[model samples]
Structure formats: structure tokens, C-alpha cells
Target: MWWDIVKVLYIATRWPWPVEMGRQRMIVQTLEFAATLGEVHLLSFGDPPTKPAPDFISSSGMLEMSGLMGIAGSMLRRPLLPLQSHLFLNGPATAAVMEAAERIRPDVIVFDMARLSHLALAIHRHYPGIRLVLDMDDRLSKRYQRMLTNETAGDLGGTFEARLPGAIRFLVPRLKKLLLRVEKSLMDRSERRAADVFDAILMVSALEADEMRTDCPGRADVVAFPPLINELPVPQQDFSRSVRFVFIGNAGYAPNAEALELLDRAAVQVSKNTGSSDTDYCFQAAGKPLAHAVYKKVEVAGFVPDLSAFLAGNAVLVAPILQGTGIKTKIIDALEHSVPVITTPVGAEGLGLTEGEHFICVLGEDDLAQACLHIIRSPEARGGLARMAAAARNKGLTSQNRTILRDRLTFAFGL
Candidate 1:
């Protein structure tokens, strides 16, 4: 059969709208791209707008399950499932998925995240020979595992100790450890099941894909495709006064939250070392509210509608991501926007971005501060970094790279 004749159905746990997060944007981009190749249908749990698109099917809002009832049902039916899975694998969501699959009769079913991978078995049973593809973009299990390891190692920098009151800090670590342990156990089982069920498991990072493959020895082949950017912005030309650093992400997210804490610490040290007042340095945060503790130094620009425009206006994109799994999409976004970046080596993982060439890599708060100051002081350095980053983005991640990713997706499912 020709690839164009393949019917693809995408099932998502949440609505892929507004394109705020990396995973969400990936889902949206895939759907849009896939529609061009074949007949595509989207079924998701998030509430749809009043006038939803023809191709988009949303779960009926008929019965809003009571919180207690939902919890009780989850606990009874799926004792070992993670809380997220329990919330998603409900009656309404299942019904919606089945209805869409039946109506579409898709040859290929794409689960946007591991959360929806449980549906693969049921869909395959009903459809007999459907190709199941699991796009594990977020890598929830690996992210949580890293967090667990960090917590266990007593490296809880941006955890309960910082968030909660000192009075309860003693108990917070123990409670957190218990919760993470249980969640990790459940996720391990769930991820393994996902690997066993899906024909192809798509990951954003090669390291994560390898880890998944190791966990489920002879299951599906895990494929790694770095974060895809459909378009690239023209490189920023002007590098002017006032050293400005911008960080973009949902600040509520654990990894981003921790990274923000690091940024805050770095900002303080930078200011103190340079004898620069708050006015001399600007830490603009986009996508979510800045932390209250760093409110004085950081300016909160909640959810900028135009991310590219935001990056264009800023001097450098600072990504001090301490811990997370999978590729950092914001870093790619910055490079694509032609804005030089300052990120920890952890942030640059899996992107094939060189430290000195593409962006400056700094380790501790002190190093990060010095890096920022150096970039601010040196126009030649700033220009060179931006040029290198822009060139890399153009060569590595734009529409040209989409062909490679699209080919991989198609080949994986025998489209």
C-alpha cells in the first residue's frame, strides 16, 4: 500500500494546544506534519474548544467523575498504576478512544505519550493488525528516576526543603522519597508494558531510547529523534546594552523549577561579583510566573504568546537545567531564533551542540555568572556565539531536518 493511503490516528492524554511545552509542541507538530502525508485523526482527553476542528475528536464532557469516586475507582481497579495513568485510563477516556478508533479504522495508531500506551493492546485486539506507535516524548519515567536518584543522593536543592516551611522540612524528604519510590515502581512496569505493546517507541533523546531498550530487552525498537523545529527565525543582528538573560519553560515543572533556582543563585553571584545593581542585569522569565524568592531580580513574563519574538528581544537564552530526561526543546528554540545561549552541560545533552562553538557551557553558579558577564562585556564573543548557534540550528534542526525525522517515523511503521 502507498504511504499516502495509510490512516493514522493520534491518541493523546491531554489536549495539544497553545504549544506551551516541548512535548505538547512535538505532538502538535507531528499531527500537522502527518496530516500532509495521510488521513490523520486526533483523539484526546482535554476539553476541546466550542467549535473544535473536523479532524479533532475530544472526550464527551457528559459525566465529570467526582474526585473521590475517581480515586476510589482507580484504587480498586488498578492498584499498581501511577496516579496519572489512573486519572487518564478512565471510562470516559477509554470510550472516546474506542469510538474514534472504530470510526477511523486507522491502520496506524500513534499514542502521543506513554500515558496512552495502555490503549494499544485494546485497539490492536479490536482492529486485529493495527500498527501501534508510542511517541514517548516527555519520558516521564526517566525524568522521575533522575529526580529520585538526585533526592536519594541528598542533593535536594530545589525540593521540599526550599519550597516548604523549615518546620516540616524534616518530614518532607521522607514523605517525598516514599511517593517517588512508589511512582517509580509503577512507572517502570507501565513503561515496560508500553515497550512490549508498541511497534515503535519514539524518544527525544538517544540516551533515553537506549535506556528503555535495556529495560525491555526484546520489545519494540526505540528510535531517537531530536526536538523538531518546523521553522527557523532569522538570526538576531543587534547585541546592545544591559546584559539580559532569558529562560523559557513552564516554571511549575520540576526540572524547570530547579533550573530556575540555579539561575536565581547564579544571578545573585553575578551581580555581587560585578558590583552591578539589579538594573544592570535583567533575568526575564517566560512561560510561567517567576519564583517569589527571586522576584526582585527576575522579571516574570507569564506565557508569552510569541516565543520567537520574546527570544529576539532578549540578549541570550539561559538554560541552567540541572536534571531532566530527553532533549531540551527551549535550547533548540533559542538556537533556532539565532540568540546565543548559556546553559549547563546537562542542558545541552543529546542535542549535539558544542559547548564553546554553539553555546557557552557553565557548571556552577559562579561559572555561570562569569560566563554571562563575559558575554555581556564582549560584543565579538556575543556575535560569534550567535552566528555559530544560528548556523547550527539552520544546519541541524529546521525544515531540512524534518525530512529525516519524517522518514524515520514512516519507515518505523512501514508507512
Candidate 2:
């Protein structure tokens, strides 16, 4: 008889398969890493009814105690659940994950985000010996607090719909601020308690790990584990195209939506300044919709089937994000495709890209327009930037990086 492989269960608050956004990228990467070790079991909630299945044997929250609990939790949590889902908690999702964990009795349990730490709490209560890992995607409580503070400080600007004058505009921000404060307090306590219970608290960036260390002090072990992107299956090259610029991301996101608006404005100014009426230069955007004026020069591709092909066809990728947290995976995907990039300083954060070397980094609107014009006008400069991006891609997302992550996981779990 064949001996059964040691089982590892991954609990996600959102659908992990059919990778859509940056968080999905993390889930897919984690699944790939876990597959290399043992039989990996997946349990998820909060996806649409018809979301595609994962490669592994999986269970959905369509008809089960966990599923019902998830639905109820979503209803009760209301607006909070959507934001909470990002951290992997949301009430119903966690309940389903807990039920799955108890049934599976896996040797190790990994919670993809802090919101899902509740499952770790539940697991420790029943199966104390099982290794527990909390993958802190970011310092979430701090981020929420930052948002609250920004809103209160009037630094959020009028662009945010939440700042508009209405019942929702007035009530929602106040409610969100109150809820975020309460959630932050509860989550901070939960993190400390879970840190004592779990084997490792894995953070996405060293800066995040440092913040956690400050919070817990000498109580728990924390490790920085940045996200990993799979190596490109194709060769890198600067695709020869007529200066087409691309920006790929979920346009529904406020930062990305704002960036697109800003880019459109900058593009118009650049066109007027250069006295070019012809649509020789195009700005192609991919992903979900946003509230912005569309122009003949702008093409909204809306969620391309193949991102690599889209990037390869464009001359440069532009990211003019003014706000947000976490590493920008769009930048990584662009670099992976060896596409030259023009971005704001905020867009290039955590990637360790050198200014004017790996990509062009600009600060103001005028600078941004000028940078775009310069890149579009100079083929030699674009080529050089593309070469640098390709090199950065290899250094950032190689087989070696994956191996290092595998080893780190092994050590963290004592596998």
C-alpha cells in the first residue's frame, strides 16, 4: 500500500484560483510552492457562484455550513466585508475556512492574510500541534488607520467619492472610520494572540515585518517574505511598435482610476504642446471600468486574455498611481515582458528600481507628460530602458528566488 503524503491546507477568504488581481497572484504563487512540498488542499469562499475550479481537489462555499455562515457573515458585515476580504477575514469566509481546517486535519495550516487569522485561532484550539503560518500580505491595520487619518486630515482630496456631500458621503466615512478603529484594535490584539499561537508570521515586505516586530515586541517570530512572480516562459525583447503606451490594472481601484484620469489629462496636454493632431501615439488601458472620460486616443481594452501579449505589443507601460499600499504587480508584469516603463515615484515603490535606469520616474504632471513624450520620441532610450527592465525581471523573479522562498517556507514550518 502507498503511504499518504503529508497534507498541507491553504485557507483563503477569497477565491484563490483563476487568478485575477495581485492577491490572486500571491495565492497562485503560494499554491505552486506548496505543490512542490506535499499534497496541498485548498478551501476558499466569497467567489461568484460560477468561478472556475482549481487544479487541486477543492470545495466551494456554495452549499455547506461554512458556506451559509459565509453568506450570513457577508450580510451582517455589509460594507466592511468587502474591505475585510482583502485581509482574508470576513466572517463567513473565516467560518468556512475553520470548518475545512477541522475536517482536513492537515499537518500544517497556512492563513493567506491577517483577516483569516481567526481560523488559526480556531485551529490552535482543536489541533495545537499543527504548524500555523500567517501570511501578512501587508500591515493592514496600519493601512486602515492611515486612510482614516488621511480622510480626517483633508489630505484625501475631493477626487474621492466618499468625500462628496450626501447621506452616504457623510455617514459612510464616519462609519468607516469608527469601524476601522474598532477593527484595528481587535486585529492588533488578534495578531498578538495569534503570533503567540502560530509558528511564523510571514510579511510581504521587510518594512512590514519591522512594523509587526514593533507591535509584538519580544513575543513572536516574524519574517519578511516578499511576493514571488513566476519566471516568464518566453524570451524577452523590446517589441518594435509605434510608441504605444499601456497601463494594466483593475481600473475600479481608486488609485488606478485616478491614474488613468491623470494620464489622459497629461496625454492631452502633451499632444497640444507638440501640435500633433494625428493619433500616432496611443494609450491602451486594460482591466475593469472606472468613471473617466474616454478619448479617441485612449483605448480601454478591459481585461485582456493574455497580459504578456498586450505588454509585448506596447512600446511602454505607464503607472501614474498617486496613492495605495503594497507592491505594484502591474509594474512587475510590465518589466517581466521587457517593456520600458514610465511611472510616478509611488508606482515604483518596493520594486528597488533605479530612477532613470530601470525606468523613467517622474514627480509632477508636467514632468510626467515630458517623460512620456521623451520616451515616445527616442527609440534608443526606450530600447535601453527595456533592456534594464528585462535584467530587473530576471533578478527579481528567477528560479533562484523561488528556491529561496521554498527554503524559507521549509525553515519556517520546520518541514
Q: What is the C-alpha lDDT of each candidate?
A: 0.69, 0.65
Tens digits of per-residue lDDT, candidate 1, 147-184, equal: 77774223232321343334335654556767667766
lDDT of 2 by residue, 120-194 (tens): 766788778888887777776665565665443222222233323254345544576576676666656666665
Any residue pairs clashing in model 2, and if so which? 70-92, 89-115, 287-303
The model with the greatest TM-score is 1
The ten-residue window of minimal lDDT in model 1 covers 57-66
TM-score for candidate 1, residues paired by index: 0.85
Point out where model 2 deviates above 4 Å.
Answer: 1-4, 47-49, 58-99, 145-194, 218-220, 233-241, 276-279, 291-297, 398-400
Ten residues in sequence with the least summed lDDT for candidate 2: 152-161
**Index of the highest-lDDT prediction:** 1
Q: Candidate 1, 15: how far from true, in Å? A: 0.7
Q: What RMSD value applies to candidate 2?
A: 5.5
TM-scores, each model vs. reference: 0.85, 0.79
